[model samples]
Target: MRKNPERRASLLDAAIEVLAREGMRGLTFRAVDTEAGVPGGTASNYFANRDALLTQIGHRFYERLEPNAALIAQAQEGPRDRAKVVALMHELVERVSSFRSGYLALIELRLEATRRPELRRLLTERIRADVDANIDFHLASGLPGDRTTVVQLVLSLNWLILERLTLPDVFPEEQVHDLVTDLVERALP
Candidate 1:
């Protein structure tokens, strides 16, 4: 039988917790099953294999960010002399804080993926997609994209800085909004 959406989210939640508490070294189909209160092999049914499971976790990270992305798109689409990019970021910080337990698991996955080409591609794409979205936003903001090098540097900083932000997902949205926007505008041409 197909798992309900609630059950599926529960599985992912279990995977994140188990991976966080136990690290990649300890996560397994059985452990995820136990943590999620699903029967053994249930994880395998959804994830197919360990690699697939890890990959899904990475994908989930991006999915979690979609709300933030949508907000950014809307803000940019609206009228503003300044891009107000941080507005989007602040909204994202607020949204992510609730479902914020997955960062550690994702970081562990990145480390594990470094030695595994397949896994590396999964997380790498997540970063790339983030950058791509940022680039789209920057471009839509009417910024000059003449310097690819500078654009990349700023994009990298944005993602890494947000990643370092606390998870349970507490963050001062207003402070972060002001701080990040100042940093971006200062860095801009």
Candidate 2:
């Protein structure tokens, strides 16, 4: 009911922390309030319900996770060969690795969405747009993959690599790099 942007952002950040640490089952407004060190009911004041909080969390996740302008510019300047694509993949994996908790929270939100049709539809549209953007980026950068192949590679390999890197010692960095390289090479023209 109140219009406090900073407070809202803090609540969302706390929600992400709660989601990452306690999973969706633990993502109550009270949990977020505790995580944010705010008084009880603080999160609920900002978000009307769990669905609203989860939706905002999903939106904020993408806002925080999308590649920045500088990164995009750097990618644009680089050679658009297989090596560059592999390098980009490495960058992506490294970014996810660095933000492991945030990404894990995202994964939890995704899983939670499956049970809610409205949430599922919203997230599906957002993910599709993200994939479309990736496909366009690849084409603009002169990478050698058709839209279908790029879509598949992005959705499948990104999930696999993210899941692998999130868990303990599932795969080494070199192995991930090699795997991404192989995938990119296969997808390339």
Candidate 3:
């Protein structure tokens, strides 16, 4: 397989767009090549197979969604209180929702995972690690929450993002902010 990091990243990004726009059923090497604006067989050179592409996409989703260094620094500056946690939750929602296509593709991949056991295992492991990291971070940061609080916020906020993406009318922007505040306030000590 080709080992060009930049090319591989581009192909994976194109795959994400294809998955979001076309869903799992429409995702293919040809579709990714077209999305990436590369010539035929380009994506095939980078990925071994559909499962490999899907697994890479699962990893890439988290890579794209991770907070930047500046945001982490800013978060660390503030007092670790319930209000800070609320701000963090708000930031989290905004950050994840900002990458609209990535999150949408993740949803599609999740549904597809139900049929593919390998994909199911990959997503489960990655998501579990992410959840664990969040719990550990919350505990170490002295954030006004326990493991349950972090879990609740993660679960609730993910659905909130889904709602915001799939059904924008259900909760307007301002209402979502208010809801985040309410969720954090109620979840924390």
Best by lDDT: 3
- What residue runs in model 1 are displaced by over 4 Å at the alpha carbon? 1-6, 68-73, 93-99, 141-178
| Better lDDT candidate (1, 3) | 3
- Misplaced by over 4 Å in model 3 are none
In candidate 3 the C-alpha lDDT for residue 44 amounts to: 85
Task: Give the per-residue lDDT of model 1 (tens digit) for 1-189.
Answer: 345777776787798989878998889989999999978888777777788788778877667656555565677566553455445445544565445557667778878988889989878877777767666766667644434633644554446444545331444454555665565566544
Model 3 is weakest, by summed lDDT over 10 consecutive residues, at: 71-80
Clash pairs, candidate 2, are none
- How many pairs collide in each candidate, listed in order? 1, 0, 0
| Candidate 1: pairs in clash | 97-169
Candidate 3 local lDDT, 117-163, one digit each (tens): 99999999999999999999889888887999999999999999999
lDDT of each: 0.67, 0.81, 0.93
The TM-score that candidate 2 achieves is 0.90
> All predictions: root-mean-square deviation over Cα?
4.3, 1.8, 0.9
* Candidate 2, position 143, lDDT: 75
Q: What is the lDDT of residue 180 in candidate 3?
A: 93
